[model samples]
Target: MPASSHRPSPASPLEDDNLLPQILLRLPPDPSSLPRASLACTRWRDHVANPGFRRRFRLHHRRNPPLLGFFDGCGSLDFHPTLEAPERFSLKRDEGDGVRRPLGCRHGLVLLLVPKPLQVIVWDPVTGDQHRLDVPQGLTMNECYESVINGAVLRAAAGDAEHFKVVMVAADGDGVENRRAVACVYSSETGAWGGFVTAPIPYDADAHASGLFWRFSTSIYIDHAMLAGDSLYWQLIGNFEGILQFDLERQSLSVMSVPVPIYSKGNCFKLMRAEGGGGIGFLLMSNSDYIAQLWRRKTDSDGVA
Candidate 1:
């Protein structure tokens, strides 16, 4: 026989099968890369789609967390505290455009609502992504409409241990009959604005009274929330005195009160759940400085006086 004929025959199909599992086990976890490898063949996709493979992919995404971009000056970027631990970002008028007042932020996005007529810009704090969302169309149509302003908050929720919610409130244009206040929520998981909720303004007196409670309340809001297994606990300043909790799952409201000093009319800032006894603290700005006042659970030492 010729020397070339001495080559061994190809390995049985079983040998090819044995090699596949090994290749799948080693595929790169980057979601961008995994999708491409999956296109190579049916077997590749099967392996890439494995639950174990997906878990690893998720882990990688978790590690390379996206950065939230924000603006300090009109054209400049603000970088402090990083995105992980947020520090309060301030807002001022754009001077040139009287319409865009730098409003506070909620989720990674900040709101800039034009004072009178109503124009709004939702800008991301990390990427500086800007989205111009219109005020609820229904509110604009009414001829009786008058003043308007937007309020926002930002936070990140942990597991069941804590729930974080960002509330976007609109001080409706007061009509002779009602103060048509509206509240909408932007959730991290669903990444969409929640349905518009209507609440009758408790005080019919004037615009000044609408935000009275916000002056002294201490509230915590999440800048982002996870889906699949995330939890959100939120409280709403239903009028000045009635506090309400919004359960994300049931999409319903429950009545609750933020402790006296905790929700009092003040600079309303910074909140974290307490340890052991589990209370909440409200930070207030006095004169020109800020202070932390902790409100703990009332002990049996004395019943409600």
Candidate 2:
């Protein structure tokens, strides 16, 4: 048989440009996955480094991205790896003053709060990209209760890993009858902070009757924000003990009381997505009975839980 007539053995399936990406896309969505794959050869490196491939890789694993590690924001800002050796990644410890606190992490980004100058740092550990945004005038130290400020970071749009947005919320008051919740959002794409959204915190009659109103006035304890539907929820503790809601689509702020009353301190509660992904809710542990209760916001009703 002529040499030209005889067919050469089938080239490795991965040699095909189309097939190569499909195989790489199945790789675990680990911090070191792409980099390690790229070391294989120039061809593989080019495929892994392609912008299109990167986007697809993220989308393919969008539903369940691996928990690479967590930032230890207690006393110091450090990353503790959870993955095994060789695949594990490490981030440089925060060199600035220990005032930096990790407010929340979502969409592969970390939101940090720096209280001194009242700034928010949106960091992407994988990309080593950092964006420092000045706190909005209304949410700044001089304007609001600086110690109670918290925020969250998320992708600007679904399945979008490049652009992101930061939502910062704070409780502000004059120690009089003007207590309120204020929130402002910073968009990376726009490179600016949006106008402030304010919601009046209703007076707690019980707190006032117990003579605890004044002490808690102008002060609030806000937990990390949780995203659900088109809104972000934060568990509020203080005179106005409820969940503060920031509607991303409407750009409005509102508050909803918890199903059961909870005190300012000595209570354990968390804001989370309701079961079956219905809506936002909270899990509260009763101090007296030591029993946990799950409460879901009634999206069909008027914010009842």
Candidate 3:
């Protein structure tokens, strides 16, 4: 210790301003703990709130949870506590039930399907805000068939909460040989439905049953979509066995096959959005072997995963 007679030693490097952020970056990935750490001081709060810090924090964790929230695959909506994501909060529906099911979820918004007159509701589980838009008219209203078709949420732009788009690949008719599909887009900004974009179905739609019991198991939409850049990917029905990609920017549709050669019965496949590279990844899990295989897309290559 020194009292003016002698010079005090320089403060430790830990006390330096630069060292604070480096310490905060080491915070556990559990987002619930971050606010508690921020309570320590305003400086800690600033560090924790930084966007860069949040990105780095996600990458730091080895086994970061994949699901933010999920559709219960039945006719209800709830959060999975074990797989809960602190960044995106859970929602509770107040509307009296009359066949409400989760259609799609993306970018903090969830698409829900409600029948009787046929409608799709866009909901933000975090803020408890929602916008309801009627499904396009002149299309097939078979609730059993429509629920299985693919739908997706497209953000208007990153960090723009006021606008987003809800798109659906709906069935034009339920014919057997030449099944046709139509796409409808709903813009939150315009608050109206867009014109239907039509296309030819590759495979037979009648191969799968169309009943309430079959509705849960089968659909033209194989699984929830994987968003990469401006495109959204959805796995196809069993007969087709491929992925349907919709380019939000171009407003076009293209089909691609699964990486596997022969589609096995009861095999599980998932399309995932790459964490860092902004590319896409496909996860395959076959019942034959319990091993899970993950393949990432190669941007430079012409056709590789």
Candidate 4:
């Protein structure tokens, strides 16, 4: 055999055993790239698809995360979270023929409410897996315009498969100028829409009688809720004193007072998981300045923050 014939082909950095993790760590945060990268070769595919690799990839990105994407009422918006140039791509629909807009986005899943028949679709943009959920019975076709609907998507467990819960709050005006309203919830695991757990939203009685409540109701509808711990916190549009709280575990409803008053739009408040582990926390941003205040619910304190 000729000596030249015995020489090996050019070495690929990917072929280096010690450099495998380093190579994988540099991959884009988008899940769409996983399948294509796996197809590079059998060994590469297995390593890329490995459970541990996926977990580590998630952690790495969490620390130095890329811009996966974001959404608005119009449609899904994709932009790089970091300074890197944004990747160009279009979102694919697993089902439905007509146009559907995003109603809620969380836990990497976009909850889309389709018009015409009024259906709820939970889509995992990463896995391309989708679930067409049943709309709440209380949400009637005719009453749609008269009601306020708020929804949130929650992952049942972290780092798990398609297990999730979709909660919807349909509040209908009592015709008393928005001082009174009714609401309901729908759960995916139980496959049922729960009953109406109504509550009276705080209103300025003196101002309400003067028709101020009616005018305020036009702009100050209850919407944009946040999920933390076992409760969902909904901000009152015009009211800065309190927030509507729904306990998912108890299926009960109550009103919670804010630590400080806020008059700006509801975007100033947010609910997030506690970093120390367990419970939830509230992030209230100051309107006058760039400062943000965080209040955490104590695990043993029974809803006290």
Candidate 5:
């Protein structure tokens, strides 16, 4: 046999152009996975950096993206990384002189409410892209109570990652008996704010009948927009404690009272998606009993479990 016949082949499956990408696609969907792999050699770096490979990597792990980190959204916009050491991703930014409160985070976008000028800042931490949108006329600070301004940010379409939309909800009241919940949406693709959708806040029947004007100071809690089905939910605080529902498809706003009365002090509750992708629900923790209860919204009726 010739000497050349005894030599090993130049290409293996791992080194093959066609098979290399398929192997790389199976890498764990961590923020630092690709970057760490790229440090191996020049070829691996080029393979991971390719636009097509990047897109495929995202889609391949779309179902369960890594929990990169979370924003505190308390007094400032701070991102606390969950990944350890080398894999940690930092998103620290100068909030400037104006106070910025996080409204909600969804679909890889963060919604922030700037109180001074009354605008929402749509921020993408990964790409460092920001889109500042002025508050809609109906939900502006002048039009609605500034303290109750809350909103949500989500992608325009499920598969469309580049563009997003913002839904801002605020409580409009006359400080007497006339109180309404107003919402307006902003679309990135259209670059315009949609018309206002208003829903009257149900008055306290007992107070109204007693000849005393129902004046409950209501405000939407910040940084907790829970999306279920085609709608978003937020917890309402103040004299009226309930869950505010915003239907994305119908562009309507409604309120649902909680299963039990939520006391103003030491009330710990969070809205969440029910198990098996059922519907919106909430986990309530009793301060005194030190026990947790999971309540699922009944699909058949307006009751809570």
Candidate 6:
């Protein structure tokens, strides 16, 4: 203990450089894009790729928590790391009852659907960049059929941040609508919703009905480019039989089957975003309690599920 040195003046009581660690716990690592985020990369891969991030991202989204929008009705939007409780920033509705439709998360923007307007609204929630899109018009609505249909919006694939796709399934339409349930893919980059990819009916019934009661189940991000090898996966309600998968590379839809003994009856309980990134997951709803089941897209299933 030299008098001159004096142990660096007893560490100066507050000469703290360890503040970085404490701050880190409060500030999450930089998040990667939805697709490539799960895969390893040099872009803060270790931190942004945390499974915790994946889980939080999914839960917050699946359970957006209904918020009374600036309209007659209300629904909640995802809480982006940048904007927590985005429902607070939700823009007012112009005409619809604000039937909240959690389309999908793309480029930090939450895609929503106003059931009454039959329109799609792209919400920034953070910047509150609200854009409403009237569902094309002229093309007959799915309600024309007695079958059943669901509309979902999803961010395309990697490197296509500027684009988003809306997939609508009008299962078993009467007259010409049978098996004619076309998948309408809307590209924001293209600024239009075009093409009829034909959504194969996984269930003969309304798929969303649970025990005579109409239950609205959301499609959970099952797996990302990681599992699809290039496509994104989503788990829909109606007996967890299969997942509706969209191929970002080719822009197509196929079914991802469930493993044996799992028997996804089609009633997927809770939808969770995958921790591995890229996609989301599902929670099995049971009377006893909520149990979770997991799966990834198998390149071999080929829509059989």
Largest lDDT belongs to which candidate? 2
Q: Which numbered prediction scores highest in TM-score against the true structure?
A: 2
lDDT of 2 at 111: 81
Which prediction has more favorable lDDT, 2 or 4? 2
lDDT of candidate 2 over 22-123, digit per residue (tens): 999999998788999999999899999899899999999999999887776554666777888433334444455346778889989988777667677787
What would the TM-scores of all predictions be? 0.42, 0.85, 0.63, 0.63, 0.80, 0.50
lDDT of 3 by residue, 1-305 (tens): 76667788987855755787777767665546677888997778887788776655545553443345455655656555444444545455546646676766766578887764466778866446777777776554454345656677767876554578988875444543444556677788888877766656566344344211212222355466678888877766544456667778888776665556324554667888766777667777878778788877665556644
Off by over 4 Å in 3: 1-73, 81-96, 139-145, 171-174, 204-219, 259-262, 274-277, 296-305
- Ten contiguous residues with the weakest lDDT in model 3: 210-219
Give all candidates' CA lDDT scores. 0.45, 0.77, 0.64, 0.60, 0.74, 0.46
User: After superposing candidate 2, which stretches have Cα over 4 Å from the reference?
Assistant: 1-15, 86-98, 208-214, 218-220, 264-266, 299-305
Cα lDDT tens digits, model 1, 71-128, are 4433233545545445444443355445355555543456565544454565644333
lDDT ranking of the models: 2, 5, 3, 4, 6, 1
TM-score of 2: 0.85
In model 5, the worst 10-residue window by lDDT is 206-215
Between prediction 4 and prediction 5, the one with superior TM-score is: 5
